[model samples]
Target: MNHIPSLNDIKEVHERIKPFIHHTPVLSSASINELAGCEIYFKCENFQKIGAFKARGGMNAVLSLSKEEQEKGITTHSSGNHAQAIALAAKTVGTKAYIVMPSNAPIIKKNGVKALNGEIIECEPTLEARESTVQQVIDRTGATFIHPFNNYDVIAGQATATLELIEEVPNLQVVMAPVGGGGLLSGTALATHYLLPEAEIISGEPEGAADAILSFKSGKIEKAPYIKTIADGLMTNLGDKTLEIIRMYVKDIILVSDEEIIAAMRLIWERLKIVIEPSCAVPFAALLKQKERFAGKKVGIILTGGNVDLGKLPF
Candidate 1:
C-alpha cells in the first residue's frame, strides 16, 4: 500500500469502515467557546464504536488484509483504545484478535478487549516490552500484525473521521487532534490537505509524553520517558512511518501539562456532557495554553476517546 493516501483512498476508507464505525458528531459548546475564546468544533470520536476513533483504522486494517491473512488472525499492542479497536474489528471481520496490553492498562479497556473475545497478552508498560510480546505472538500464531497507528491502511482508515468532519464543517482554519502515534493526526492532515487545503493541521501532545513534539522539531524519532500521566493512551512513542508523515504534514505540535489536561477534560465533561479520556483533552488544553493564536478562529478538535475507568477519575 502507498504510504501516502490519495483523496480517493480516504473516500474508500470511509466506505470500508462505514458499516463498522459511527460517523460521530461534530459538536460545539457556547459556554466552552466563551471560556476558551475560540469557535471550537469538537469531532467527538468519544462516540465512535469501541468508544474511540481507533476503530476506524483497526477495522480498516483488518478488512484490508487478505482472506488468508485474516484467517490467521490479527495482532497488535495498545495501552487501551487500539487494543479494543483491533478486537472489535476482528470480531466484525470474523477473525480472531490477539492484543498485547500493558499490565497496568485500565481494566475497562481490558474488559472491553476480552468482551470482544480478543486474546490478551499482558506485558510490562513499555513500548519495548509490548513490541517484544507482539513479536512472540506473531511467531506463535503466524498472525498478521495491524499496527495501531503506523501502517498505511490503518492511517487511511483513521483519515475518514477527519474527512467526515471537514464535510460537516468546512472552512475550518485549523484541525487539531491529540497526537499519540500519529496515525490519526497523519490521516487528518491528509484529509485536510485534500478536502480543506486552507486548513492547518495542529497536534496536541502531553508534555510528559512529548516525543512527537521533540521528533517533529529534531527531524527524527524520539521516545517519551517513563513519566506517568493521566493520558495513558498517549504514553507510547511514535513510529518511523508516523514520524515522517507528521514532519511533512503537521504545522505545529503543542504540549500541555498533566494538570491542564485534567482541567480541560473536566471542562469538556461538564460543558459537553460527554466522557472524554485525558488523551482526548490534550488538544483543548493546547488551545487553552495558546488562546491568543486561536482566538476568534474556527478550530476543529478531535475528541480521541471516551473509555475512562470511572473508578479512576482524576478530578
Candidate 2:
C-alpha cells in the first residue's frame, strides 16, 4: 500500500468503494466531439457521491484504516469537496470527522460538510493555516489526519476513476484531467499507464494557480507564482509523492485561463446538459485549446466535480 498502486491495487480499491459510491456514468456529446474534433468520453464524477471524485479517495483512505485508527476518527483540510467526502466517509464507518476548511471556501461546500455532520474549523485561506489548523485538531482530538492529495491511499482511491473509465471505454488514445495537488492527475496517469499503456495522459491546470505544470517541468514540488483562479479545487501546489508519480507517468500539463474555463463550463451545461464547476471544465478546456493535437482521436476526460457556488455563478 505504500508503493504506487498496481493494476490490482486500483481494482481492489474500486471493489472496496463500489458499495459506497456511484458508478457514475460515462457521457458523450456529439456536438462536443465536433467542436474539439475528437471523440470524447466524459467520466461524470459530478454525479458521484458528494458530487465530486474526492469521494473515491476519501472512502478508500478511511476504509483502509485499521479499527484502532477508525475509532480515533479522521481529520482533513479541504476547500470543500474533500471535506464533504471525509465527513460522509467517516459517517459511513461510524466515526467522527474533523474538517479544517478555509474561511473563503464557497458557502455551498461548507454547507455540504455541515450537512454530513463534519466538525468544521475555519482557518485563513492558505496552506500554512490549513496545516496548522489540522494539526491542532489532531492534537486536541487524537484524530488521524488524512491529507487531501499527498497520501498513497488517497492516490490509489483516485485511480479507481480512471480504472473504471478504461474498463468502460477501452483503449482511449488520450486521457485528460485537471491537476490540483496532483492526486487525480497522478492517479489518472498511473491507472492509464497500467491499463492503457499506449494512451497519452494529459492534464489541464489553471494558468493563474499554475504550479503543477512548473513542478512537472522542474521535477520537484514548486509553488505557484500567484494564486488566482475560478478553479478553487485546483489552487493547491503539488505534493512530493504526487510529483514523483506525475513526473514519471504524465505526458503533459496544459494551462487554461478562467475565460476558457468558464466557456468550457458553459459548453457542457448547454451541450451535455450537466452542471460542472470551473475546475471540472479544465480538461475539456485544455482539449479545446489544442484541438488539432487530439483531432480525430478517442479521448477520455475526467470531469472531476460539480460543486460550484450557485449564487456566485461565473457565467
Query: What C-alpha lDDT does candidate 1 achieve relative to the native structure?
Result: 0.89
Backbone clashes for every candidate come to: 0, 0
Report clash pairs, candidate 2. none
- Positional deviation of residue 25's Cα in model 2 after best superposition, in angstroms: 0.2
lDDT for each of the candidates? Answer: 0.89, 0.92
lDDT of 2 by residue, 1-315 (tens): 688888888889999999999999999999988888889999999999999999999999999999999999899988778899999999999999999988988777788888998888999998899999999988888899998899888999999999989999977999999999899998999999998899999999999999999999999889999999999889888999999999999999999999999999999999999999899999999999999999999999999988777888986
* Index of the highest-TM-score prediction: 2
Determine which window of 10 residues in candidate 1 has minimal summed lDDT: 220-229
Candidate 1 stretches with Cα past 4 Å from truth are 124-129
Query: Each candidate's TM vs. the true structure?
Result: 0.95, 0.97
Which pairs of residues collide in model 1? none
The alpha-carbon lDDT assigned to residue 1 of candidate 1 equals: 61
- Per residue, candidate 1 scores C-alpha lDDT tens digits across 15-122 of 988988898999999999999998999999999998989999998889988999999999998867888899998999888999999899878778889999999999
